[model samples]
Target: MGALHVLSGGAARGLIARLREDFHQHTGRTIEARFGAVGLMRDRLLAGEACDVLILTQALIEELVVAGRVLPDSARALGLVRTGVAVKTGAPVPCLETPGAFKDALLAARAIYFADPAKTRAGTHLMQVFQRLGLMPELAPKLRFFNNGSAALQALSEAQEAEAQGVLVCTHMTEILATPGLQCAGVLPKSFELATIYTAAITARSEQPQAARALIEMLAAPEAVADRRADGFE
Candidate 1:
């Protein structure tokens, strides 16, 4: 059999990668996955990308269902993933117990890494938070934007080796934990927290609907709750 095509948001990359070998073993088919910003993934699907499965924010999945692009009955939510903060491994964890502390930490950092605000949920929310705190002008020069959370965190991890001082990153908790050389400090302070429900569905145009559904079942299986939590899903 040929490969199963999947387009997923960066938030679910860890879980999917963890389960890839098992899925291939069970189904005798490899998975071809594209992980990126949710908005970019949605745009890919809309632009006629060949996809057997689609994993994205719950609201986006529902919108696709109504748009007749995905199977309504095949949708299942993986879990909630929160936007969080991260620091380089072995670096001092910043105090983020309150909104004020969070602001202070950002101001103190030499640089701040994050995803593209125009193409990701976490990035968009973080932008709003910075604007709300009136730090946009002050922090603008320190911002380093990437295409997705995983990339931002990866850059943060690499930056640590080159610089003696540590930097800060804002992305989904999953991305923080999944990336090596990075430590998950914690979720963003309550006032600026963003918890998104990520859901998966078989695409309406899937060539292997059964395989796609099986992959979704594996991802959302109740028995995998602990694994999901370890992977930063709530």
Candidate 2:
């Protein structure tokens, strides 16, 4: 068997890290995981990058399977992740309870941070939300896009030191809740909430198919259930 290289989206990072750690301790297998946007990882895989396992949005996994970049029948549903807003721990929390209020919050912020709409599922849906709310044109100037949740959170942390009113950050709830120095501003209004289902599959380039399948099985096993459940995967 060989070391597993997992390419995953940021929302699944916490659960994946914990699972990988536990699996390693139980089996002495090394897992090297790189987490980022699903679209980013999908693009890299399509361009011939080698990965033993790919954990991404379920839709993306199906697309890669069709494109022959991942093995068919090797997919495992990981979790359902919802998009949420975040602010510096001690900063004022914006009201995102209703569509109109959420729109106002976005308009009132000096600067806002989110994942790349083109590269991440949460961001992509959020773009639609902005358009639906008719805030895109007005809020465009204040928007800053990052690669994924972690990058967006990091930018939000830096923005805390900027002007008097801290910047608003929004991304997957899982990532926002996992980090320190950030306050969970709550998920989007029901009318605007978007949940992305994540899945894992053995890559087409995997040299250790058994090992990869074993890991995938472990992910769905009872031992890893609690971590996955707590991380927003259902």
Candidate 3:
């Protein structure tokens, strides 16, 4: 069992702990994982960062493959995860059934927060949601972007202190809501829900190619899927 360095997207946030345990148990390897937004991780890899494996959206992984960063035929789909929405614990749940209702919820929100779109696909889609609902101009002034989950959670926590409402992020990081102080608001209705599929691949220059492949297989095993769903992905 050797050290396997991994560069991955934020979508895998909820299931990391389980994945680490399973991979270590299976191959006796310790995965050194670096999770960031897909775009940022892709930039770092393109800039020559060394990593044994890469786990990210299939679209991004295929882009890397096309650019000759990842080996052809190495990309393997893990599963799909849909973006989600939640409110901090104790907050009143809002009606998000229709597009108009969702827009109203946004306009009524005091301070809306989400990950930086340039760095995250979820945030990018959320931006599109705003545009589709024709609420961009009105909501733009109040929108706040975070670097990562911790930043978003911090904003959600602090909003209550100032007696202002905060719009929690909708992404695979939905597990963060179970962290004691946050509550479950509701996910976007089916009409607006976006599902993102994840894929894992060995980098073209990976030193631990075999180990990387083994880890990817372990992550896509049956048990891993259950763990993933428990973490708020589906």
Please tell me which predicted candidate would have the highest TM-score against the true structure. Answer: 1
lDDT (10s digit) by residue, model 1, range 40-84: 999999999999999999999999999999999999989999988
Cα displacement (angstroms), candidate 2, residue 51, comes to 1.0
Candidate 3 lDDT trough over 10 residues, lowest sum: 171-180
- lDDT tens readout by residue for model 3, 78-167: 777766565676777777777677777888887677788876767788888888888888988887888855467656766663453556
**Local distance difference test, each candidate:** 0.91, 0.82, 0.73
Candidate 3: residue 162 Cα off by (Å): 4.8
Off by over 4 Å in 2: 158-164
TM-score of 1: 0.97
What are the clashing pairs of model 3? 87-185, 88-183, 89-183
The per-residue C-alpha lDDT of model 2 at residue 177 equals: 70
- Relative to the true structure, candidate 2 reaches a TM of 0.90
Q: Per-residue lDDT for 69 in model 1?
A: 97
lDDT of the structure predicted as candidate 2: 0.82
Task: Order the numbered candidates by TM-score, best leading.
Answer: 1, 2, 3
Residue pairs with backbone atoms closer than 3 Å in model 1 (clashes): none
Off by over 4 Å in 3: 157-166, 173-180
